[model samples]
Target: MSDGAPDSLIPYDEIVQEALRAVVGRVLGEVEAAGGMPPGSHHFYITFKTGAAGVDIPAELRARFPDEMTIVLQNKFWDLSVADDHFSVGLSFNQIPAKLVIPFSAITAFVDPAVEFGLQFQAVSEVEEAEPHAEPENDSEQGAGNGVGSEDGDDGSNVVTVDFGKKK
Candidate 1:
């Protein structure tokens, strides 16, 4: 990994990203099983690709965010449903309730500040071998507009980002 060129035999980056994405599923599943977040100040800020496959959100929300958006799971949310590969929930925006269905593959970041936990992923569409994007100015930085964090205002402790090269 220290070398400039990646190894051809192993898709180590993709494999690791997949595993981290699974952690998103497991955590969501746990919250679903418990009826809600455990009895504490625990909550989640899930940032995802709005345009990714399997993502379903209101037109207004899509129009507003277009590319990515972060949602907070705290009070006043309803209908928490978790599936093998996706999850859905109802949240309020400016007093208007909206239902959002997001596949685990669409998520880019997951953060739980109560425990300072976070996992970042590359939206499946962002790293397709068939499509290439311009490089960022710095290797440590993400592409323009890809670094938008949550508007939820969680004291941001450990946000993670994993770039598989394409996954939006």
Candidate 2:
């Protein structure tokens, strides 16, 4: 047997990212199959790029989060649907509901604190170029939902932040 490292001609990052995005799709699909958020699980925190292709965010939200934004999918959300290329969900802000269409390529993080499970991905690109490492910000201390507990009591309302950094 060879003891040397194996060579790779394919871009592993792209392949991994694609696979991760598929996990997001599969999760959403499960939610859809259930006809709603599972019992005791009523929300999600989906963060994505504001400028990525196929991302449809409100002008106000876009301005507020010019580069990235995290959306809460809880009691006030509706019309949750997922497609091969994108997913759409309706959310309320100030009691005004808005529909957002986010492409999987645009999604950066997906979290469901109730189960302590999460996924992170690199932004998708339309151009045929090498996918860059646009790592998601790890703001667990600032309550960005990285599975870190807080002073607040445990009500299954925790948020999970995605960390794209390699474990050292």
Candidate 3:
């Protein structure tokens, strides 16, 4: 080839990202349909942009996180409602019950470390750089050990992490 590959006119990256986000929705919808308990040892660590559009969380939580927040879907969550573009669930923070509504677009990562499976996505919303926040302490009494899985300490071969950096 005389010239390098031309930049794609098609928005393949966006298409692929949206498709992966749908996978998250489908998995959550199945869990919601199955009475809110993930099948067997499959638990999730879902990270989302706290300030993204259509994200409805408590003001206190928003203030605390102010950037990104990850929640566990294992031992203690309820009223999970999954829609095509969003899902809502009830969780606890500091023993206080709260409801969170998160759009799939706001999600940045979805991981089920039980099987070392994960998906990383680029943030769908524009966000400013900020200091890293602390891990959320949801009321997961037995929530997959540390809530980020990897308890077995195996190499993370099953995780899917994509980097679509364009050629310089």
Candidate 4:
């Protein structure tokens, strides 16, 4: 036998990623069903590729975050709507209210800092890497700063990380 493992014919990574993305959809759906309000201190930090297909954000936001952007869904947000493959919500940027429509496929991370739960996924798009930009000003208090992509002091036991380790 060869030292390397043989590649499997199944697209396990894609399947698993799709399934995991559904968790985000379900959570958002619950909030939507609750009259667009999150229960208690629950909030979410959603990170997505700005250039990904089916992503719709204000032109200024797109310009500000040409590569990727992270939006917080907490107090001061409204119109929380969730669809099968996408979700849209209204959030304020610099006190300017804007509606963002982001597809689940474009989402790379979802973090619920209130419960220290998070999910990280591989990019579904061939996004060109660019300099990281500051998080958008959503007019919400920057709490413990448990950002979806941050590796803070938290043990992150609740964070679900998926890495297929595809061979080149």
- Winning candidate number (lDDT): 4
Which residue pairs show backbone clashes in model 2? 145-160, 145-161, 146-161
Q: How well is each residue in 46-163 modelled by candidate 4, as lDDT tens digits?
A: 9888877788999998766666788888888999989999999999999899999999988888988888888998887444332234344622333332255557326745888788
Off by over 4 Å in 1: 1-6, 126-157, 163-168
Candidate 1 Cα RMSD after full superposition onto the native fold (Å): 6.5
All candidates' TM-scores? Answer: 0.75, 0.69, 0.81, 0.83
Looking at model 1, which ten-residue stretch has the lowest summed lDDT? 130-139
Q: Is candidate 3 or candidate 4 better by TM-score?
A: 4
Residue 44 shift from truth in candidate 3, angstroms: 0.4
Q: Judge candidate 4 against the unseen true structure and give its global Cα lDDT, from 0 to 1.
A: 0.81
Better of 2 and 4 by lDDT: 4
Show where candidate 2 strays beyond 4 Å.
1-7, 125-168
Local accuracy of candidate 2 as per-residue lDDT tens digits, 1-168: 756545557767677887788888877777777775744764567777766777787887665555567787766677889899789988887777788998888877776676765666655565113222222342222233222223222454433333333433
Candidate 4 clash pair list: none
Q: Lowest-lDDT window of 10 residues in candidate 4?
A: 138-147
lDDT tens per residue, model 1, 1-168: 464554468877878888898888888788889996644888887888776777899998775666667888987788898998899999999999999999888888887877877777765644243123323242234233354443333565566666656543
